[model samples]
Target chain A: MASKKNLVPRRDFIKTSALGLSALSIGLPLNSALATSCGSSGKDKLGIALVGLGNYSKGQLAPSLLETEHCYLSAIVTGTKEKEKEWAKKYNIPKGNIYNYENFDDIASNKDIDIVYIVLPNSMHAEFTIRAAKAGKHVICEKPMAVSVAECKAMIKACDDNNVKLSIGYRLQFDPYHKRIINLSKENTLGSINYVNADFAFTIGDPTQWRLKKDLAGGGALMDVGVYCIQACRYSFGQEPIALRAQAFNSGNEKFKEVNETITWQMEFPDGKISNSTTSYAMSVNSLFVSAQKGKAQLMPSYGYGGIKGFIKDEILEFPKFNQQQAQMDAFALNVKNNTDSIVPGEEGLKDMKVIEAIFKSLEQNGARILI
Target chain B: MASKKNLVPRRDFIKTSALGLSALSIGLPLNSALATSCGSSGKDKLGIALVGLGNYSKGQLAPSLLETEHCYLSAIVTGTKEKEKEWAKKYNIPKGNIYNYENFDDIASNKDIDIVYIVLPNSMHAEFTIRAAKAGKHVICEKPMAVSVAECKAMIKACDDNNVKLSIGYRLQFDPYHKRIINLSKENTLGSINYVNADFAFTIGDPTQWRLKKDLAGGGALMDVGVYCIQACRYSFGQEPIALRAQAFNSGNEKFKEVNETITWQMEFPDGKISNSTTSYAMSVNSLFVSAQKGKAQLMPSYGYGGIKGFIKDEILEFPKFNQQQAQMDAFALNVKNNTDSIVPGEEGLKDMKVIEAIFKSLEQNGARILI
Candidate 1:
């Protein structure tokens, strides 16, 4: 999106940044894995308020926020008043920074938090992101962007209209393993890629979870962890798939009554390369393999929340696992501070949304080749 | 296929086995790895001959035969005079045991050789297998069985008619890693499996190789290595897929004009478990993951000629890699001597052939699933 001119002033951004206290990300100088930083004393750090206190917030984002050099988790929006009190005391957030879901819109006048990180369920992404942006804060939404392409567009529009940057939480894009693999493709180290095999599947412990509901999740596995497979293909080739064929199977168990248990698909790029992938909520598998004219690369347990390792043939791509969430959060904050688009901008998530739509459509057609 | 009526006396079978020679297999009081022995004055060893000198024969079978206890590499059948001289000299075979393709039938009268191992191309499997059976020799034909189901049926009929056993060379059936994984499924160690992801893909170094030729290969990667993926799912579930949906993709490279570069499919069994697989000639990948209700199992570089490792959830299934071909050959010889069916009999091969046919049909129908 084109930059909105003479809108949110540079000084206002800094004023909000000065209010930042602590965060889940730690950017200090240049880390071997990525360019990270500790914000200069002249510039106040940006403060981010997480919209949901779900597992992701409690486990990853909240902890990483302390490490972020440019941003801190200064506030939170949660329906649980008990959680709000506990978090405010634990994280040392002032009472003024605490807000419940009903009072979230009132954040517009509060200058303490400059960014709203939406980590809610899939269906709630659009409403929260739009509200966050309209509240004069840059927005960072977790992936699948939204339940549909329309919601994604609306979020993008809301952020653009408010002159606030819109970023998506695609943490893997900042990960060293994937970044190196993408670099290999960019440099044609393996020649033209001929094939890609990516599968991400795991047994869901609770079938009654919100993720299994179509209205809440938009789809099944594809809307959740499957986005990593899509991201892998997209980043590896730096090209969109031109056509695709897909199929969804319900693992006849009663647990899968509400959604697909397994979904498999193959996408063909204009160049004739194929990306074949499978995602299931009823199986455990994580892998990514790329075959090119000159050589091959493979990574088992490819897409993980942590500890992702891989190899180019027999030689491994070695790097210590760093905090991916911290890297992603700090980068978003800097991008927002600079009034520039984040690398995982809303558009990146929007592209995946398009692919997701095509995949479901292909399955609806009973595995017909659906042109993108 | 039904068992053939008695031809060789039971005593004769025991006599041949008691004379067990340096074999491509040793199923005796199991030795450390190989307990190759030459027949003594009291026993008449089963003498086997190889019909091809391709990479598989040269790199795997030939070396393995030297270690076998029940059978020995007693004769040769090759169209190439150069390979005949080299192999005869290298393995110390008698001149009488050497025969060209033209004189292969004449071996029926030689009495020195009891088996014919056909390691030729896809199209040649049936002809050589039938010829060997007609010559009164047990036959081991490499997979895909034959170019067509009719040919597979013909080969089985010829072997049954001649009262000679026929085994398909599916070495993984003998590998301990796969056997254990299959056992886990059989024992319901992980509970009823809900999903499987299997893929085998390799870059074809030579575009003009027989494997890339339509008539020579019968098909592309699916017919070659993809069968491994199929075998994995079949054995893991111990059930034939009741239905399938598949799609074929071209690698877009001119080198793949004669056949598909990649073909991906999903097979559904009666219990609602799904096996999603991919086989590609244009990429390199090998993996198998099975997920059941209780837990998951994974194997990487899973279906290989050798060097396979895997884990059941967090626990690795540890076993030193051994010569799979030797075990396979040894087991086949023991089966023949016992007058019982080889574990991977002609019918086992015929079953996979049916699946292959269904997969192709599904692709031809634009991925409309075909019931098996």
Candidate 2:
């Protein structure tokens, strides 16, 4: 009975996720599940038009569409003519569907593109998301939704004004391991978790990368990988922090002249629990630890593109792996087909940015505990 | 070749420590290897007197003494009459060797008792250590050597005045896994380590226990378990922190009214690396992570009395295991037999307390970054 209580979620998830991983068609894709309820929607799979041909769009999103049952890569919007040509031939995207940035507004009239997945840089997220919404397409923007909390709010408002759905690409929210962890917490498995330790770090290379530039990146490690740690604690506790204090450190490396090399923070929850976390661009560390009144759950090398392993109490959790990008895209595609918003909507991104903004503020104010 | 460079310390340590673990004599104990120069000093095994029969002493120290070759439990001191009577009978201790706190000084004449291990509460560490030294007995005091750095310094001075050795009971210092980590750092096996994350925590019960009292326990998690986290970061970095900042949180439970429930801190090392760590009494967790330019090394559930597991980059590390308490005691006994001091002297305990004090000070000053 005790084992049953602890092991049920992972077992059930792995059994189903193993099938979903191979293809998003457990029963003829997710969109068809809601297709009969749609009075006028008769599309086979929602057509997704990627708004940026960057590494994320070209590598993860485009490839993920091959396995996604609810969505197919249909069109692409890019500034580089060479990339537009390259992506069109590779994904078999029709010439009529390949739109440049200057002609992105014309996507409103293109019936071939049902959703615009905004996979642009940090500073460009709000503009592209707002523009995509105004172009009569549902929007799924990459993380940080925008550089600032205000931008995130504006993006949310723009999507609402245009009667379109918006989702920040927080793929980890759909991960089996992450879902299992949240289920454990919800089931009171660890007993009102009061302590959370989350960290994500990797050595940054190339000083000339746009991610190191404050204008394009908005912030350093926080805007990039640090957001994952923040999300982990927030999701683990299921409670927003009421107050936080933070410290920032930078390597003497010339590469970090415009940004922090590392940042550590403590978030105080309303119930007196606290989360201690760090995100670094000067080192390599990825893990999450949560402690409650009963027992602890932890994982090292957690929150990766793949190979996230951890344990709940004494049970080693080997959750089935899947294409994270495919899962995320399928989720958004289902929302687009059903005319509903994803669970991880723009508000989720806004909350994370609010905490992040306060963290940077705390660092600027010499490590003061700032109310969020 | 790379494997050889990283795995040599474990190989050499296991080759020698395997012998030390089973019997303190490889032919003779480590002290005997140094003892021939001493005139008329020929002891087969050193006698150790345990002061204060608390949980740690009763549970760990007593059982571990049975496994140790260089040291045996020869006497016990306790203010509690029933405990003294019970322990003396169980350990077959002679009546003359047993004493209460009031009569502890008379042990000076008992040549059978060579080392006095102070396992008392934090407040009593200084008095017992200084008295034991004056009684011509070498001292091994438990961590958080005293309530204040001043007491730690005084304890050291007393030991130096009496020409007796003093060692802080940091059992993990002898742990094979920890030794591997330190060796990796000192050897630059992981490149110049730039980031370290170490946390130790456990939920404290019993509102009336001495650990809950500010006077008896000194401080909360920071002085107790948190010191281990501090030690881990310091040893992993192989550098002392130049500056540190901290935050303290409390469980709403009335038991923690006098002390913190959790404390998180960031220490800035001289080479621009940072160690972020936390200690908690409101929950349970233990882990250590260190990252450098080359790779990283880490252990979760790292500081337990047993089952300390970790990895060195891509390889899972499995070092030879020994009884932690026995290793610590035998090493101290060897120091006694050889007329030498253990490596973790009173000054080491003092250094930890100084950092701990600064952490608390930083918390008091609203998370100010203090120069260490």
Worst 10 residues of 1 chain A by lDDT: A32-41
lDDT of 2 by residue, B1-372 (tens): 112222224433443344344335334454432232121148787788999898899999999998898989989998898987789889999998898999999776565678899999999999999999877678999998998988988998987666567899999989988888888877888788878989998878888888888999899988899999888988888878888999888757788988888888999997678999888887787888888878878887799888988898888988766788999998987866655557688878888988988998898899898988
lDDT of 2 by residue, A243-285 (tens): 9998988658898988888999999987788999999887788
The estimated TM-scores of all candidates read 0.86, 0.88
Q: Write the per-residue lDDT of candidate 1 for residues A1-372, one digit (tens) a residue.
A: 444432455644453443232122333222211111111223457888999998999999999999998899989999997898889988999998998889999776565677899999999999999998777688899988998888999999987766678889999889888887888778988878777878888878877888988888888889998898998988877688898888888857777777788888888886667888888887777888787777777777677768886788568887886899999999988876665557888888888998899988988888788887
Best by DockQ: 2
lDDT of 1 by residue, B1-372 (tens): 444433444643443444343121434332211112111112245777998889988898999999988778888888888998899999999998999889888775555666789999998999999998876678899988987888989999998766678899999988988898889877888888777878898878877889989888889999998888888899988888899998888746877877788888899986667888888876777888887778778888798877787788778887886888989888888776666667898988888888898998888898987988
Alpha-carbon lDDT of model 1 = 0.80
**Model 2 stretches with alpha carbons more than 4 Å out:** A1-40, B1-40, B319-321
Q: Judging by TM-score against the true structure, name the best candidate.
A: 2
